[model samples]
Target: MPHLIPDTGPQRVITASNFVYTISSGLYLTAGVLYFTQAVHLPAAQVGIGLGIAGFVSLVMGMAVGHLADRHGARGVYAITLVVRALATACFLLVDSFWPFVLAVCAATGAQAAGVAARSPLIRHYGGDRPQEFRAHLRAVTNIGVSLGALLAGWAVQVGTRTAYQLLVVGIAIACAASAAVLVLLPAVMPGPVVDGPRWVALRDRPYLLITALDGIMAIQFKVLTVAVPLWLVEAITAPHWLISGAMLVNTLIVIAFQVRASRTIDSPAAGAGAYRRSGLAFLVSCSLLSLTAGMPPWAAATLLMVAVVIHTIGEMWHSAAGFEVSFALAPQHATGQYLGVFGLGAGLAEALGPSLLISLCITWGRPGWYVVGALFTVTGLIAPLAVRRAEYRQRFRPTHIEALGKAPVA
Candidate 1:
């Protein structure tokens, strides 16, 4: 088995950074909605609208911030974004009305979006030749840290006081500040050689853009698990209410235990494409099983749900592993941040739009909706290899003039 913890200096720093940042995000995510509705006394609609707008703004600005990271160093951009996040989190304390709350949400979400734009470049820079392995280790550490943070947040929720909410928000800000300090300790990775090409080359890469869109579609699994499953169990199936929590627990445990092992084989573009194919099969089977849960006996429904969760978690692991490999492997070394930023749009859009889309399809349309979702996964997974191959071919056969323009060699 590969080491769960990284042995190299840069890898260790990356792992620590992921752990701390994810922990802080966990604490904030668990408490932010409650704080907005209860302590800040914002109506639920206002809160939703404000956050939705902020999320959209973040998505739109991601590529621009990535260009900044490519010009500056990823490490510096990441650290600056952390500090910005800390300040934005602090602004939550001053929110008394809808407009103020919206501004705070925008600031926090924008900083987070920019930070994400910087993150993958930092990882690719520090991960040496085995970025997938390093990413797997960081993912495992993230699960552990987020789990702990969630448990701690649970205690605060149980306290159920305004002061408790305030404390959680304050803790998130302090954590962000501390994480920024930790990032400063990381050795700087210089930006790649300057490329004099058009600033929006990623936008012009058609094959890569298609691959990114497919990635976004695959990411709908997150919404399926979080939104669709709960609604289906409570409304459509005769299963126990606790089964919702049980399914998530199984997913979390499996990911923590086996994600690194699953990622061990994904070392090249072809291998990454193969992993995506496997993930599609897993998702299809899991969705098919889930569609069978309606009108079943409680015991049988519970069993089916558990089985589906396990299968879905497997797909989740493989998809993540393959995504990291393909994303890094296909990106030009000089424009890593820009490409990654563009790639992130798919995930951002999925998270932004997936809940309503999946919930309507799965819960409202029932089994047929699940079948459609399954087909979507299968098609995206199958087409991913073709997209990767096309991109590779383009890179291999680029015009001599384009090559001479200093396209950084792929890693």
Candidate 2:
């Protein structure tokens, strides 16, 4: 037993979370393409509807599942959810009909919801009382997992698309199972002494809600990069497939390296808000860079796209960390999971709506679409700082300056 186990620290948490997310990444990489290919056998409208239904279900039910984790505890919930997710992945091998695909996606989405809900709250619970640092660390770990997943998926795709899908299902099942087994052996949730009264009261805080809304908007950038950018690369610019893949890989690798370090500079809500403001500015600049891509040759466009992605990726990491920190700091003792779930809602909505909106803009505006997206991002990003300022003024409470917040506690 001693030889089998390693030290429990930041590395341990990162490893565990990375394992879970890596599996998730592998599953998602193939699931969408596989479902669509299978869609070729069905009506195109049905395929779209089926995927939409799965996403909607995940968006709605994810909060409920997260709430349950808050009330019930994370360990048992994680174990059970992973088991279910694994079983659902296995069932995908038999999904021949449209209805079956729809149902399978719903199951997988639910599993994803439950799994993330459990994992994030657990990180917060263990990170003493400073939720922001904990949340940032968790995000860093997950991003690292995502990078690893992309690499593995790239290899899987090269083997053969069908073979990749089959292996993805199998790998996802095994990974989920392994994570559940390991998570069960960890310590119980340590959210500190339960203070008396309602944790739901955290929802009423003005700054917290505003921050979450900003988080939702910032999340759209990710939606653009993954869904919108790829389509533009192929259809609009007619760029080579390798350019698209390489750019994404570059973005992922950079994120994994810098997220934690960059996030460390943010300390208080006000400082976070400042970071958010900077993020907004960076986004606008990135969008401007993207707009230039439309006017360039294919190779030149790919280079510009790569540069824009790098800038956008930076803004994403900053805002993501700041958003999590804000949620963790403002959440009441007993309701960390609940408030976090509400924070998670912003992300869920972005995932649901952002892709379609970006894609639509791309299709409708053509070369001009990049500018439209740039304008939207610039406006939204600018709004975040103003909202932060409004929250500061309306509350009549000056946030604690980062100078006095003390050093961040180690994991």
Number of the top candidate by lDDT?
1
TM-score per candidate: 0.94, 0.84
Number of clashing pairs per prediction, in order: 0, 0
Residue 140 shift from truth in candidate 2, angstroms: 3.3
**Model 2, span 1-411: residue lDDT tens:** 122122456436545745575656655664545534642255667767876787678765555666666667766676777888878877777878788878887898778766666655675656555556655555656566666666666665666556566777777777777777776556666333334455554456666677677788778888767787788777766457677677777776766667667767776666777777777778777877776776577778877888888898888887776676566655544555566766776787788788888877775577567667767766766676676666556445533331143322222
Per-residue alpha-carbon lDDT of candidate 1 for residues 63-133, written as tens digits (9 for 90 to 100): 87787777778888888888999899989999999999988989899888888778777777777778767
Stretches off by above 4 angstroms in model 2 are 1-14, 35-44, 154-164, 190-207, 386-411
Q: Could you give me the TM-score of model 1 versus the true structure?
A: 0.94
Can you give the lDDT of residue 310 in candidate 1? 98
Each model's lDDT: 0.83, 0.66
Where model 1 places Cα greater than 4 Å from the true spot, the runs are: 398-411
